[model samples]
Structures are given as C-alpha cells and as structure tokens.
Target: MMGLSYFWIDGGTYLGFIVCITLLMFILIMRSFDLKLRRKFTRVAMAMIIALAAGALELGLLAKGDTSTLIYAALLLKYILEGYMEIAVIRIVGRDYKKIQSKLLWIPFIVISILICTAPVNPSVFYFDSTLGLFVRGSLGYSIFIEAGFYLLVGLCICVKKWFTGYQRDALIILFMLAVVSTGVLLEEAYIFDNCTLTSSSIGVLFVYVYMYAERYNVDSVSMCYKRRCFYSDAAKYAKQEMAIISMDLNDLKYINDNYGHQAGDVALLTFAEVCRSVKTNKFILYRTGGDEFMILGIKSSQKEAENLISIIKEKLKETPYTCSFGLHMYKPGEDFEEAVVKADKAMYDDKHIYKSNKNKQANKRDDRFDEKVQSFSNDIDFFDEGE
Candidate 1:
C-alpha cells in the first residue's frame, strides 16, 4: 500500500498470521465446550489474536515503506493488548478476575498507554526513525516490557502461593504458562527470534485449556472444590507432614433439597465451602469429598490449631443460613492416613449427632409453648361459658 516495489511478508509476519489464525480456531472450539473461566479464556484468546494481527500488520508495513504514523499506532495497540493478556491470564488463578485488585493492575497499562499516545509530541516512549526505516525504542520504551513482566511476576507469585496450598498440578500448569509467555517475550525483545511471541502465547493458552479441562475431572463442579480423588492424593502427599484432618458435613442438606430444591442445596454447599476457604491458610487445603461432605487438610497443625480453625468456621457459618458439623483429628507421624480419616469421620458424626439433638430440643420447646397457649385459650372459653 505504501508503493514500495518489493512488499513481501517476512518470517515474523508469517508466524504472526499463522498464530493469529490458530488462536481464532481455538476460540471457536473453546466456546463449544462448557468450561469454568470460559469467558476469561475466550477474552484472552481474542486479545492475543488482535495483538498478533497488529504485530503482523506493523511488520508488513515496515517491509513495504519507511516508518510512518500507522506503523507506530499498530505497535502501540499491540503493546496495550500484550499488557492486557498478561493481566487477564494471571486473573485465571482465582476470583480476582473482576475484583478491585485486577482493576488496580490496569493502572500501569493505562499510564503506559497515555505515554505512548503522546509519542508525536514527545518521543521518550517510542519513535520511528525514517532514515533507517525502523521503529526505535525511546527512553520509556522499556516501560511496556517492564509492565508485562510485572504481571507475569504477579501470576507466578499467585501460582507459588497456591502450590503451598496443595494445588501442585494446577499451580504447575500456571507456572508453565508464565514460563512460555516469558520465553516468548524474551525471544522477541532480545532479537533472538522474530514474530515468535504470538506463537508461544498461543501454545501457552492451549496448554492452560488442556489443564483446565483435566481439572474439571478432579474438581467438584458445584462447589468448585477438589474432589474425592484429589483429597486422597493430597492426603497421602501430606501424610508425612504433621497434619490434621478436619472433616465437615453440612447439616440439613437433605432438608434444603426437599424444601427449597436441589439448586438451593448446591448453594448451601458452596456457602459452606466458601466459609471454610475464608478461614483456611496456606497450610490448609479444602476438598469436597462427597455431596454435602467436605474435608480440610491442615499441614503442620496441632489439635489446638484445628480447634481454632473450626471455631472460625463456625462463626462464619452463623452469618449464612446453613451450618456445618466438624470433626478434627491430628495424625500421628506413622499412623495410617485412612485410620486418621476414619477417626475424623467418627468425630464428625458425633458432632452431627449433637447438632441434631440440640435442634430437636429446640423444636420440642416450641411445640410445648404452643400447647400451653392452646390450653390457656380453652380454659378461658370454658370460664366464659359458665359466666354466660
């Protein structure tokens, strides 16, 4: 379009176009599947495609003619999209995707964007060199990479934190993602390779999707907590550690289902799980082992710590309409893990028994009050009849 006789695609543009098309296909396939965080995945994939397309366009323009405003604008858009992808990918780790923390992470991107927008007036962020027909980084040009790296670091930290919480597989998957994207960015930035960033990112997104798809099998769909197999696996993994098992069961789940519907029952389970999560630490891992039954494995915990954990959970449960009964058992260094689980199970059943007994007692008291009021009314009626 710029009227250069030789206008052909370079290696970078070819790779970018290829990666962009692949990402578009990935998005289509991803939409067909029902996955948790599906929207977030789609958003990042779309952003990646856009970024790749912009990068390819800039490369083609650079090949055709001298550097111009259009090329600079394309570069700016690519940077912004890259920054967004970093932040969005990190958000997949937890619930922060739409939270204030995620929004706060955007501040750096906004600042960078404003600086890039004023490049015409001030070339400190980035400028084009017409003499060499090249795009050159200005003083603040490094800011974009620094910003992208900051998000990658944040994502890596979150994954590391989750690793300590017994999410080894999930955390490792995220770490792999960071590694891939970081390598891509390094390759492009260091001139080691051209137009490979988009390809690497696309591969990373695919890996994450595969991991997430596998994760669904190990996760409780309703509560989004680890399932029975994960619990078993983690229990054995932490068997040598000074761990405590906290077994919990929701009270009146059947009642909720019968009276309010199964959907309400699901809400109760989710609520109980959330309460447990709120009180859990890095030393603790929460699992939904069965319907209305959950467990927490607390690493390096004492009986007293388990008690405090239960207490905190109870207080949180009071705010919700549902309640949970808990049983705590500290594992001896060499004790059978299943035996320890059984002990915890027994304790939980005992707690459940107590909870049921107290509930029945309250019900009986209400019934007794009703009977007395009825008797009092009947006696007053007989007295009025005699007086008449």
Candidate 2:
C-alpha cells in the first residue's frame, strides 16, 4: 500500500472490484458442483484465482510505477497461471494435452521468466514512467508479449482442434474467448485501454469453465470421442436431418492384445481414435460405443461423405498397428434409429467377414507355397541319392 497505487480509490477501481468479485463467486459456484468436476477443474480454479490476485497486485503498481518488484511478481504469476489454465481445460476436454509439451520451448520460457523477474537489475524488459506515473514496457517488453501470444495460440490450437465433444460450436466458443483476451491485452499494451488484458483473462477463464469443463460429461476419457450417451442423445435429435451413421470396429484387437500385449492394444485403440478425430469435420461427431466399436453421426451426410471420411482414416492406417472395418448407412427421417443402427451393424459385420476372409486366403496361399518348396527339395535329394 505504501508504494502501490490504491486501485479501489482510483476511478477504475470499481470495475476491477466487480471483475474480482465475479471471479470469486465463480470459484464458489464451481465448488458446489459435482465432486468429480470440482476435483478436475481445481487447477483451473486455482489459476483463475491467481490471475485475480495478480490483478490486485497490478493496482499496487499505479502509485509507485518505478518499483518493479510487485509488477514483476504479478506478471510471473499471470504467466504461470495462464499455462495452467490452458493445460487444465485441455485435460478435462480429453485431449492428449501432453502432445503439445515442448522441451525446446521450456528452456526459453524459463529464461525469459527469470529475466523478467529480475527487472530492477536492468530496465530493458520494463521500466516505470514517472511522467505518466505508470509502468511502461522496456526493450524486452515486446518479446514478453510475443511469448504470451504464442502461449495463447498454443492453447487455442490444442482445445479447438483436437478436444471438445461438440467441437464445431464448442470449439468456436473457446476461440472467441481467446480472441477477446488477446484483443484486450493488445489494446492495453497500446495504452488505449487501462488494465484491459487482466480483466478479459478473468472473463475468458470463467467462460472456459462454463462451456468446456462443465459440459465434459459427454467426452470419452480413453478414446477422446464422445461417449455413447452423448451419441444416442444427438442421434434422436438429428433424426430429421440428412444424417449418415458410420459403424466401425477395430480389426484384430484380440490378436493385438494376445500377441503384443494389452498395452499395445490400447495404443492401437488410441491411435484409431486419433484417426477418427483427424477426419472429423464440424458437421460430424464421433463416439466410442463399446470396447472396439465406434459410431459417427454426421449431419447432412451421405454415403460418399462417409466413405471420404473413411478414406482419410485409410491413409493413416500405416501409422498404426491395427486396421478398422466400417459400414455406412444414411438415416432416413421417421425411420427407427435403432433399426437403422442394426442394419449398419450388419453391414459392418459383412465388412469384417470379408476382411477375415482375405486374411485367411493369404495365410492359405503362404502355406501352399511352403509345401511346394518342401516337395521340390525332397525330389532333388532323392535324385542326388541315385547319383544323378
């Protein structure tokens, strides 16, 4: 309080107080929800609270803009919490968030954070403008912004592209939130808005809770698809639309589990899930119905569209140890969804039958060739015994 500006007494203090109170209320509301969701989003709650606290510290800097200690500490907390927020959202959404971890970026981020923290030793990263009575960017200020921009973009890409059950509409919500926060930060940096970025971040984090984490009941944790429950609910709703339902089963899952071990089978299953996710468009939703079986509900879809989606998976078949067989059916309005599903299932079994047949034929052919080679060798030996 001695050196820092009194954020409340200032004209802008009211707005900050309102935003901070909202964040606190949000934390309490989330805690009252399902126990599992509370445990799941604990990191997000912590991160948002830390961000709020940083904003409070930020107000302390208005009085003593020249003192870099409080501001630097605030910034450090903000950056760390930003990372945590992204990771938490991605995790709850069932994305393999670990795939984005980069050992290469870690060193640079650590170095930059350390450099920014030691602001008093040198003023290149940031300095207090006594004339304006505000903290201004030093030489490395732009670099810090760039790094923040990179982090925000990474978070967006992780969630928007790979996670979220209803990715089309849901992913857009995430993208929009990120954009709002980024715009606020940019405006603040340009001195157009006072303390805009921090406020925007608090709002965005709250939205993330409501849109992504709160609605995660449908997301499948193991396969990263929507659960069967999600699929059935949407199927009934989309019955009137020109929908294509795809029934698929992983080929030879039992063989993989027996020969290579269950872990390998899991990898194969996850790999197939990734393939499904890769081919998914905004019009489609994928689900894991059973152990090795999956379904996709595609709006305004056709057999050709379904085949095209399958083709994309075929291209990536080389990347995995397993292959999948599928059947496509166009769901007619007024038709029993279960009947249509049964037909699609029959079609999938036909495909599986063909797959196994081909495999067996190949095996038989190999055996025949082996037998022929052995007979020829025996005849040659008999001729040599007769002294050719």
Each candidate: what lDDT? Answer: 0.74, 0.66
Note the residue pairs that clash in candidate 1.
none
lDDT of 1 at 75: 79
TM-score of 1: 0.76
Q: Which ten residues in a row have the lowest lDDT in candidate 2?
A: 379-388
- Model 2 lDDT tens row, 13-95: 34544655665566566564445555555556556656655755665565545455656677667655655554454444433
Cα-based lDDT at residue 205, candidate 2:
60
Error of 2 at 165 (Å): 11
Estimate the overall C-alpha local distance difference test score of candidate 1.
0.74
Q: Which parts of model 1 have CA positions greater than 4 angstroms off?
A: 1-36, 63-65, 96-107, 153-157, 160-168, 235-244, 257-264, 281-283, 298-308, 319-321, 328-343, 364-388
Question: 364, model 1: CA deviation in Å?
Answer: 7.6
